[model samples]
Target chain A: MKNTRIRVLIAKPGLDGHDRGAKVIARALRDAGMEVIYTGLRQTPEQIVESAIQEDVNVIGLSILSGAHMYLFPKIIKLLKDKKVTDILVIAGGIIPPEDIAELKKMGIKEIFTPGTDTKEIVEFIKTNVNTI
Target chain B: MDYQEKKRIEEAKKQWENRILNKVLPQFPERKEKFVTGSNQEVNRLYDPLDLEDFDYLADLSFPGDYPYTRGVQPTMYRGKLWTMRQYAGFGDAEESNKRYKYLLKNGQTGLSIAFDLPTQIGYDSDHPMSHGEVGKVGVAIDTLQDMEILFDGIPLDKVSTSMTINAPAAILLAMYIAVAEKQGISKTELNGTIQNDILKEYVARGTYIFPPLPSMRLITDIFDYCSQELPKWNTISISGYHIREAGATAIQEIAFTLANGIAYVDAAVKKGLDLDKFAPRLSFFFNAHNDLFEEIAKFRAARRLWAKIMKERFGAKDPKSMMLRFHTQTAGCTLTAQQPDNNIVRVAIQALAAVLGGTQSLHTNSRDEALSLPSQESVRIALRTQQIIAYESGITETVDPMAGSYYLEKMTKDMEKAAMDYIIQIDKLGGAPKAIEKGFIQREIQNSAYQYQKDIEDKKRIIVGVNQFRSEEEPMKDLLKVNPEIEKRQVRKLDEVKKKRKEKEVQEKLKLLREIASSEQNIMPPILDCVRSYATLGEICDQLRAVFGEYKESIKI
Candidate 1:
């Protein structure tokens, strides 16, 4: 019944506990009339991918500030591809250096949002790119 | 001035606002409809004598080192001795961080503050599957006492005062430190240092928790008992508001929540039949210094005065040292911007100056390139030099609280105290900090404030120098410090070697004893020390406790 609205999973995909930006974006997405499921701190990439598939969410927004994006983001994307769950729009935000964004995008992360990104931009990106499966 | 003179000034100020100001307002107006502090508290255009008509100087702010300690903790303040210049630095493997420590100490740094990596902080060995990408990422990785020994290889424990920023595994790390000191042929009594053992903020903000709150508090009280008996100079717990502020708490919430947690620790220790005066003197605090110069200064002053009163009135402490709220301050990391990263140096300088003006006991100025990556050697050197410049070159340290009697500062300090106290009263009604955090009251409040802060920035209500205003195109920063992925492989391999070299029989026996002590009502510190002395890994010891005290499952609320 809620299929008309976009569903998003705001996941904290690493050991980093800096969740202020993640929570803010979650609330903003919720206020923008989307359903947001926030996976709290210390979640592994496997848990994130499983939740994305289980919830049938339209997007998986990964947030990590612990400098583990180079290792963790690829694993999550690989897991989604292995499961053939390609419809989920993958995005990330945190302390990602600019040098890593190209490889991350090539690995299937749709976009990489760094620090100081406005939440409105994230919301618009998700709404425009969400693929209804 | 008398009451009549005060009345005349008040009337003249009102007339000036209405008559002269009204005429000029038609052509030009204020930049914003209202100005607010960093915490969103409204700031008036000006503060004068009219604001402090009922202010009592003697009772409210006694002399330095006197009751209430509103002026400063020491009698002469920085005139007697400059504050300790401690830079918090750690990354990569133990060898890498050891070199950084030696580098810092050689460059006029007075103290060492250790930062542990995520795996070390969350009680996982570097080889643990969950710690694959995280080893030696955020901070240094320590798998066993061997790693700790390598961390302080040449550093003399008796000479240098160290502060370890570890919480969930604090006792294990502290025990390793003690073992390292013993190996150095130094007595435990001579070791002067502190451990960030405060765990309440973990549930609210930092989230490096392993055991649940009940068992975690017991471990904290055990450390209190052990340190008071053995290491008298070692500060047991540094009740911290630094992470809470960085997690988007307003300044008022920062002090209120931090002090509330402090009260809870005291209550737990007293409930365990410990003397308040014995541990209270060693109970230090840690706070953040943000860009709001006057507000941050007032926050520190109000925090000190409020803690003094809380000890005297609430806890009935008799020792003057027990009542003093000694604290360490770090310039706010959350305030730094990634764009035009060099501008962060000026931001750090202003924040550092505010900490000095507010009477911080020790200070850490953040590096300029931190917002982009881990600071390079050059950036950290500049950060340490920033503190040195304030201590030796700036004459502000020559006086004790030079901004003490300013009308605006006094009124703001008083108002901050009242507001923060109101928050404490609310937390008390919810049965103190742990209960408040359990019910998700504190987290929700911080989240709301955090969301509002982000909204303000996005809406252009707040102007960040290089982020939202005065924009400029810049090239990518060069020489950013990157932790080598090879460090992880090398660390895990070393951990394996240590595991093979240690006596397995003694490790099992010590871990067994630790489990027995943890399950029983006895203090767990002694057994933990035995485990560390036996070269039991951090993960091995924490896993034993996790078997007894279940891991904390965070209730997700966003």
Candidate 2:
């Protein structure tokens, strides 16, 4: 079981084309030996959740830069629940405010990485918490 | 070893050991501690000369304006003339943006750089349903020749160089500009400006792209061909690394990827049977000047040298101007923090100085309040003053490549050049930028770097002043410029009027001819000009091309 690979999905939801941060996270995860799935920019909530389900990823990381996180994150969480994929961990990052992080966490967002968060910490956190196959 | 040398080495080693044991070891009691810099690079306790062993002065790090222009592009650089200080100004209607342009020109700005709103960039009229909330939010709203007329109302076409940051609908906007100049009784050959027609980066980094890559490339090459023959003074495509850097690429990544894109454009034009020297001299670049002052400077130097080598050695360019890499620099907008908004003023000033030191031909400094909203008039003025202070008060402009001979800087420039060359080789292996982009290679690399930076910031390994440290208890928010919702309504009405007043039959005939030419191998510029002159809205022209070229859906990869 320890020899099994951990699959993760990195997605961008809504109309934001700013994917530099999202792409960076995906590459770091891939380099860290995770099988990462990246959905390109301008993804709807349904598109993200569908891709996550299809990829069968253990964790889902959503990146948003357009200040549309409030509307986008909840939809993803709800879709995961509806699709009976509650076991999949959901995390987010971007220009999210501290106050919004609390509400997102309430809606089952496990972690939030903002501007200053480092790659090593994100990898370490995912490695410790994610239940690899 | 000689007696004096041996003694000196031993004493230096002993001092270093003593400092590490007594000072450094105590500071980092935990051996697991990792040191990180603002640019997210893990820094060691020290960098020795051994770190830059392969550095050569004449071969790798040449003098300013010489072959392999690593130090600077021009022989005199800023000593002769400082970089054109052009602030990115545009918002609301064309009238408002025009006023700002006039204000900047009156305040001693050397050039004008326009920032069109989302509606204009995407080729939609202000009245379009899709453009409901976004008319004047991001930048200025330009719908037709009328709006273009207002945008450059009083600005003379002959004197001041202008740069329009538009892609996708770049052809339409350029046509509108030509029409405006025509109305001013100025010849097209007399006009000098740049159009941000680099659509490849729009796909890779910025998302303001309209057409698919193939058609976009065709449109860009057409401009290159047309501008070379018709508008001699115009810069057709500003192959941009600015948006790529803003999108989170490391400095090395930005330089390598931008050059790779530049190579692709040259190849595309060459395949179209155009001589490299004919259009290559007109090819320009736009790069982001980030907070890493030395690194940014090194990146710019490395860019010039690499571009020169590639042109002379690879593309077989004969003209020296064809090999020269002239770029416009914009201070990194992403580096500006919302935490300490006022501190952004200092950050921009430092970034602007870096651009000047790096030998940029032109530059635009990001205003302090840009992180929250469009800059207020006062903030924009301060941003302009930052460039002025650097030009007059700072003695940095007295010499060309002021830091040319520094051991650390020269080594860094060589290292960056080598790194960029290696990446260029890899991209070439992957069959150039378009292929690599299709495979999501460049996008993945940028994403990886961005993620690593974010993670470092989260773990407190990287300290951003006001974010992870230097906590301010109570900071007041600065007033940001807010666009009224009614501005969009006004734009919509204006677009409606333009549509109503324009000759409907003539517009239809021109558009039909435009679509035919777009489908064929003939240059699309002539038809585009006709459509623009006939006042066919941006969206109408773009929709015709979209119909021919089809929209691009990006392939996803993790």
Candidate 3:
């Protein structure tokens, strides 16, 4: 029997309550045959990483709308590295500047999906990167 | 042909068909059916006489400010006075927010809208352990009567209408406002403002709730009763659909869920033996102005018509003001993009235009830089100017309900009304908003809609400029507001000094009484007012209630 479940953790970092995009992405990922774990609003970087690590997810998708992406993404990257969770692909979505995208990529962010990046691309990106077994 | 060439050809043909056939083919039935936009995908569409079968125009789309108010709630609308241009602003400490408020007033803004930081919103003081780095991060942080006093330092409460975006701790915030007014020598009856005491949506969409549904509802009804008696000019509760829409609800869901929640408040008030007409006349609403131009307008019209009917027919509200649906609209912040930040100005203008066309009583256009951070002073001024240009330059506001009697608008309005009524029936089946919220029915619907919209964006079904399409590598926004961490230190020190200087005995007595009243079936507002008057810290008052009510842990479902 083929193990066909794709696990995705939709985490919100910092104090932004603007989770419409995050929630929508979570739903879309779930509908696209992925098991999505949503750590609801006001989650710290530590909390999100812990949830992602414990859930042992294939992909960690962080949504930051509070303009804390610079501080938050780096912290999450450092935590994932400290935990030696290198296999889990990390991505981010929300109001990230173009200047910071290169830095985020350097820090191991696989892809940055800003506003208007289609749900299908996200689904496809996850499918291609993460092992479905 | 090679595979790549064939694939390119097929894609080109598909795009061509989509552009041409979709735009042209209304003449022939075979062509028309193929070109019809999906009912669910469109949310609204153009209609003709065929769409309004069995319709009587005079009975339905009456003149503006008339009964049912399908056209509008006011006769002249902007012709008499333009919708109040209120900007929802607050950040840093109370003093900082106060300065911003004064600036907005000087900049020709007609009303004041306060955005409390997360700590104050969830009933925590800046110095509280749980508040940590979140103090005055998103909005202003008010810890005690001192902070409230500083927030309204120079601004007279009786002079300008204020709207505070607060929910779970709305009663406490309202009490603080009243106490501040008293200090300013303003009578309660002379005060005018709105407290967003709509907790049902807090549970369903926004996640700043402290207590569970039952106590929250009780607290809200307490304000309804208190305001009806004391503050005649005050809008005690602002039934907010703005958060619901921002939470990813469709236009129909936003209207229905908001109205259902409104009904829940009325039912609770009526059960408390309060007359509907007395409190209902002062009730106001807040809605999100999303990207869908025509659909948003129709949704607004349907909201007015449906709410009027619900008020007069269901609640037996006889007064015209009681039946009127007055709402404030904030253009969707979720639609803004950080990729090409400057493009957000255009998006905001379109959304603001929709709100005006939809007959909103007030409007707040989101600053373009808000997508990346809290707007800078320059960006905020530009956002205000966007509204100014529309009110002065755009001739769309010359007529009330400009889209009235248009076959497409009427048909879409009726369709939206029917869809909303369907959701209301579903909520009714689940025993109204509170019970439905408890069961997470509303949350689930919002989640589903949110998910579907995301999927559409991902699937390329919906085109969002500068994100998936019109990709650019250059940075657009050069400046964004960056809050220094020292603001928190200053705020904490201010809170500590206030605590040290105040009468501890009076504070303790007020808090103790507040706890007792909170635990009992009595109104929490009076005790809350006592605590505010005694200068009890926000954390102290909230801690007392927290001990009585216990904290609510959200049941996460995605």
**Residue B103: error of model 1 in Å?**
0.5
lDDT of 3 by residue, A9-100 (tens): 99887666677778778877887888899998777778988898889888899987655577678888999889888788888998776677
Q: What is the TM-score of each candidate against the true structure?
A: 0.98, 0.84, 0.89
Q: Measured against the native two-chain assembly using Cα atoms, what DockQ does each of the candidate structures obtain, in the order listed?
A: 0.78, 0.24, 0.37
The segments of candidate 1 whose C-alpha lies over 4 angstroms from its true place after superposition are A1-3, B14-23
Better of 2 and 3 by TM-score: 3
Q: For candidate 1, give the lDDT.
A: 0.93
* Cα lDDT tens digits for candidate 1, A28-93: 999999999999998998999988888989989999889898999999988888888868899998
TM-score of chain A of each: 0.94, 0.95, 0.94
Per-residue lDDT tens digits for candidate 3, residues B179-296, read 9999999999998889998888887777788887777878888898888888999998899998998887888999999999999999999998889899999899999988878788
lDDT (10s digit) by residue, model 1, range B1-558: 588998899999999989998899889988889999988999998889888887888877889989889899999999999999999999999999999999999999999999999999999999998898999989999999999999999999999999999999999999999999999999999999899999999999998999999999999999999999999999999999999999899999999999999999999999999999998999999999999999999999999999999999999999999999999999999988888999999999999999999999989999988877789999999999999988889899998999988898999999999999999999999999999999999999999999999999988998888877888999988889889989999999999999999999999999999999899999999999999999999999999999999999999888
| Candidate 2 Cα lDDT to native | 0.84
How badly does each model clash, as a count of residue pairs? Answer: 0, 18, 4
Per-residue CA lDDT of candidate 2, range B9-87, in tens? 6678678789766686777685456653345545455554544555567877677778887767778887777788888
- What is the CA-based DockQ of model 2? 0.24
Report the TM-score of the second chain of model 3 against its true counterpart: 0.93
Q: Which ten residues in a row have the lowest lDDT in candidate 1 chain B?
A: B51-60
